[model samples]
Target: MKTELVQCFVWGVPVYRQRFSLVASRPATERFYRLIRSAMAHAEQLRDPFTGDLECDETTFGGARKGKRGWGAAGKVIVFGIVKRNGVVKAQPIPAHDRASIMQVIQARSREGSLYYTDDWQAYATLKLRGDHVVIRKEKGRPVGRDHINGIEGFWSYAKNWLYPYRGVPRKHFHLYLGEICYRFNHRDRDIEPMLISLLKRLTVDDVDLN
Candidate 1:
């Protein structure tokens, strides 16, 4: 790896690209991003199942558009997230926000008996059979009781804020970017330098060509 590539990792891709474009070519920058994407994809597979109080929710991602807004928006990506209270979060872009789609994520990421907190979405109604499902109806003001989906809702805000600076992400590659966000959130407390170095080592030894 070139010194500029290491600098790219240290300073972050956007900063390195703006300041050192003359030092590293565009292809090298893209390669580094691809490497990060590949490492994130790998880390996503190692998630442990959620077993405690979990929050589940779905949110739409996209910029301001001409037509519908919020859940009814068109041309936007729907993402479902399951977050263990005060723990890790797992999120993915789903094809739809239907029962089958949301249930698939819950079944895969959460344990059978874990307590689930969600809004009054029809899709999550089936979760009652599989777990202790708690529904909090959406209201004008803040929630009053112990029933709130704030954990997963916070993750959605965090992800959207982090992604906002990029303007917009391409739909086809959104999954990879989503994986990266989840990886970052999962490892939020760790020292990024060592974690990134370890990922780079795995990238090299795993014989996976990210190019």
Candidate 2:
């Protein structure tokens, strides 16, 4: 079976690809994705910004398995993401989208003095005390001034677009996918070489089996 591995930087996003006869090697794409993400999680970030016009939103993604709306979405995946005004995005898959879950993420990622923006989700009301919280209602539009949640909403659009092209992704490993998307969103304007090295620096020998 003819097999090949390709490495390409897609618009500053370093992508590693493997090609071979499915009849022989089959596909280990799942393992590859997990390895990449695991390596990323280890990389140290100089700053996990928790300030600025932080836009927060939640979305669902996964397979066509049997289930209810959000309920069926259970076991699927729920991703909560935050983006700053400058187009940097951070996303993670949460076990649930309840207040506790959302709060935990916010507390971990947000700074004390940074502003936060979101829709009228009650889960974010507590942020009003933590920092400047701006809530937009469906009937009402986003804030007119500098505080708007558009950046995060734009991230949602980008994420769904990329996922649709890949068809339905498996639920078991959705967080890695989310991390890749966020990495792209966060560094869309910069060269990916540095980003790739940064991610590699985070990896230990056990993160990926080169052999």
Which candidate gets the maximum lDDT versus the true structure?
1
* Per-residue C-alpha lDDT of model 2 across residues 1-211, encoded as one tens digit per residue: 1112112223312222223322223245444445655555434233465677788888777666676666345456777887777757777777787999888888887787777888888888899778888876654554655556778788888888776755665565566566667766666777755666566666668665323
Query: In candidate 2, how many clashes are counted?
Result: 1
Q: After superposition, how far is residue 7 of candidate 1 from its true place, in Å?
A: 5.3
Off-target runs (Cα >4 Å) in candidate 1 are: 1-22, 204-211
Question: Candidate 1 overall Cα lDDT vs. reference?
Answer: 0.78
Weakest lDDT window of 10 consecutive positions for candidate 2: 1-10
TM-score of each: 0.88, 0.75
Candidate number of the best TM-score: 1
Candidate 2 Cα deviation (angstroms), residue 93: 1.4
